[model samples]
Target: MASPTQDGVLEALRPIVDPDFGKSIVDLGFVKNLEIDGGRVRFDIELTTPACPVKEEFQRAARDRVSALPGVDEVQVTMTAQTRGRETPQGGEDLLPGVRNVIAVASGKGGVGKSTVAVNLALALRGTGATVGLMDADVYGPSLPLLTGVSGRPETRDKRILPHEGLGLKLMSMGFFLTDDSPVIWRGPMVHGLVRQFMSDVDWGELDYLIVDLPPGTGDAALTLTQQAPLSGAVIVTTANDLSLIDARKGLAMFEKVSVPVLGIVENMSYFVPPDLPDRKYYIFGQGGGARVAAEIGVDFLGEIPIDPRVVEGGDRGRPITLHAPDSPPAAALREIAGAVARKLVVLAERTPAIADANISWVTN
Candidate 1:
């Protein structure tokens, strides 16, 4: 029989819905087991994806929602991810084993500074004492070579591709294979295979974060990476420009189909202030576009980075802004955002208390 508080706990959660699935977790039978004593509540929750970020969120929400119950004291939610995947037609998660965390930086449209955001953010994460890797998934326009300043062909040993070191990062890109001035073209499946090979054949080593700078707009590369990598989360990069917002929406939807949690949204090139006039602000791409999209998607708006010319110079010279001018505005913003993102990833690995079931007691007095 259910106590008043136990029933009240369930009653409070009757309206919570999964952000991606749009179904109530309780109705989905994700609330596996429940027990109540005195005022504490303990339960096991299951998810359609073992690594779904919402697994923790649901628990936290449950805890908060149930704490309002008449006699509740504590809430314990043990979440387990179960593979309930239906075959995703194109961009569903087909994670390569052993990949720690893959974070893709994407944009809704070109010229919105998505690539710049990716490079700087990757550098910022490195600053936080984590081993990081950058995959130039934008094969046709591999900017990492230009940004990282590694031009020679990547050497191969043991038949596995060795990533080039740039701005203190391990890198793999098509630009390494092409001359600095060469133009290249690729077919669909061929390009897809290349993305796959980069992941399977490279020696990524023990990386804490793998920042993948995806091509502008949702396309083959975006879909391919989603299917090939065990991505922990993604960051949608966009400007405050209307066109960019449209593109950002497409990218967000692409990741959604594959069950990828959008860690947050990043507004890049958010503001441009002239050198002479520090106080005057220029809304070059319009204001609040990125924040608006973030709200619309129900994701955390990590932060906005001002357009810094130093960033372009750094990328052009094979030095990322975070490395060249760690004190610069954009670099500082990236560092903060990077650290926050890393913390968000770890939050998914919530620790379960090891208390023996028989050793617990509830006080009703």
Candidate 2:
């Protein structure tokens, strides 16, 4: 029997295409470190993100295809990721030079659990072995310190603020500097300066993902973030109800006006599954509002998160459900949403051209 040459192995895997990029894995340069000895075949399939939803499918397909070769007896497929990012030029005034992707988690209005969703999503992304950072960009109502149980003023050295570390994530928030009852009565310019400082003056280090929990509503803080932050994409968090959906549309329009891609809409509190009735889903906020809005607005419907009391309890205690109760239904849904967000960012990075300055142009309304 003839040995399987590198050319033959590459040909065998050419049929497996990346669903997002519409190109074969071989053609996309995902296959790496190929080594063949006797009947043992070993290679690594490097994906764009650690949180890729289809990585297992790629692994299975690669093993099956290579094992079918004439001289292949054992196939070892190692899955890896380099976490693709937008082509932001390094140095020269790039704010987040070391951060690859900056994701804004926003909502149309308050009371939609946007902070909860952002906390869990950041935890979920970090769970996948990606270096993640969570920035509470809600200058008026910074909740990350409460949600992640991280407090105390961030230390500064050489004029750069070092982000606080907690729950395996680099954390930054205005709440850390304020007392529980303190109010942020800053003007629009102050909010803008604080948001810009969070990006440029914070030492976030090298992170694969930086999840910014933007202030709810398309107001000054949101506008400033959309204009200054080199955001790769934005995720709109909304409840499955008319009121929330209305604000969700306004939020979507805000991102669109600034030329930022809306990764998708995540419907939080879509339904409630009672502990007694594990199988029954009570659609308390009406049915399919999120999907309806996504379809109506022509964006991806990421997924729905069920209303679980534990999610709130955990957040209140600085333990997001995604980190503490990962096997729970709500946690699973949040992780799925995180995966979708990661995948959508990869798609945008692949389709969009690299810009010299990552900061988007401000559109006057």
lDDT at residue 100 of model 2 (Cα atoms): 87
Residue lDDT tens for model 1, 118-235? 8877777676555678888887678887788787899999998899987788988888888647677777788777877887788887666788887767777667666555566788
TM-score for each candidate, following the candidate numbering: 0.68, 0.94
For model 1, how many clashes? 3
Each prediction's Cα lDDT score? 0.71, 0.87
Q: Each candidate's root-mean-square deviation in Å?
A: 12.3, 2.2
User: What would the per-residue lDDT of candidate 2 be over residues 1-365, giving only the tens digit for each residue?
Assistant: 88899999999999999988889999999999999998889999999999988888999999999999998899999999999887766453577888989899998888888899898999999988899999998886888887988899889999999999999999999998886676879888898888888988999999999999998899887888888888889999888764355676788888887778899988988899988888999999688878888998888999999989899889889999997688888999999999999988888787776542434334111
Flag clash pairs in model 1. 50-81, 108-247, 108-248
Cα error, residue 88 of model 1, in Å, equals: 20
